[model samples]
Target: MNREKTYGIGELARDFDVTTRTIRFYEEAGLLSPAREGQQRVYTDADRVKLKLILRGKRLGFSLSESRDLIEMYDPESGNSRQLNALLSKIQERREQLNEQMREIELMQVELEEAEKRCLDAFDR
Candidate 1:
């Protein structure tokens, strides 16, 4: 007889380098659904994969809702085309947002430089 691999909450937290509270928070948010073995939470390989994706999404600046949507959209039956397309669209949107922020930061830096020059000129007089 073969048994399926399982993980405890603490084991997952250690493996993912996250706090147990974080895992619980994700569970509360409906991101992870681990089976309960009495008082202990038992996570399957699928749960582990979801946790990995959630962390990856967080690193890529995705909001929890966005990550949830993407994760929920996943369908291995259809080759995950829709999920991939949506992810690409989101990536594009994020890139555009970052570009806009960069432009704003550049403008602010120029203004600061001008202000500093004016102050230095006043001091020199």
Candidate 2:
């Protein structure tokens, strides 16, 4: 018979390249809920997957609440329509925000270049 694997807090922290405190913070944030054995936290494969998803969401610039909502939409028994739609919405919003920031950056760059030209012209006098 084959048995499922479980991990200790340290093992998960190492595998994910995060500190134990980070894991604890996730737990406190209701993102993870590892089982307890005395004082030790025992993590299941589900927990590992959740942690991966959380990191992926963060890397994609998602807020913790957004990550939590996306995670919560997963249900093995149901369709993923809601999750996909929500994700698409978030992506669109992020793209808009990034576009606005890019425009601002371009304007700032133009102003800096003009300022440099003025400074150089003054120096030549």
Candidate 3:
């Protein structure tokens, strides 16, 4: 039988392409709880998955505390549909915000295009 591969903190940091200090910071933020074997921290695949989700949340403009709240929903100890439903609501909220931003960006693009046209017309005159 083959055993699963576990990683140390350094290996996990390299896997995520983040600094060791960053991983430690996440631990400090209560995002991860890796086992401490001696002075070194060991991570499981579960931790890797949580890290991926947390990073994705950040890229999507989620606040750290919001990400933590969402991540906590995945905790095996707390099995509640309330969190899942709340996350769905949050997704809808994010969509609404992005839609509004898109409208603003479109408006800016049109304004910029008009400005460019005016500049070109002046150069031709």
The clash count of every prediction, one per candidate, is: 0, 0, 0
**What C-alpha lDDT, on a 0 to 100 scale, does residue 122 get in candidate 3?**
100
Candidate 3 — what's its lDDT?
Answer: 0.86
Residues 10-30, candidate 1: write the lDDT tens digits.
999999999999999999999
Clashing pairs in 2: none
Model 2 — which ten-residue stretch has the worst lDDT? 75-84
TM-score of 2: 0.92
- Model 3 shows how many backbone clashes? 0
Q: What ranking emerges by TM-score with the best candidate at the front?
A: 1, 2, 3
Candidate 1 Cα outliers beyond 4 Å, as residue runs: none
- Residue 105 lDDT in candidate 2: 100
- Model-by-model lDDT, in order? 0.97, 0.93, 0.86
Model 1 clash number: 0
Better of 1 and 2 by lDDT: 1
Best by lDDT: 1
**Model 2 agreement with the true structure over 46-120: per-residue lDDT tens digits:** 999999999988888999899999999987666788888899999899899999999999999999999999999
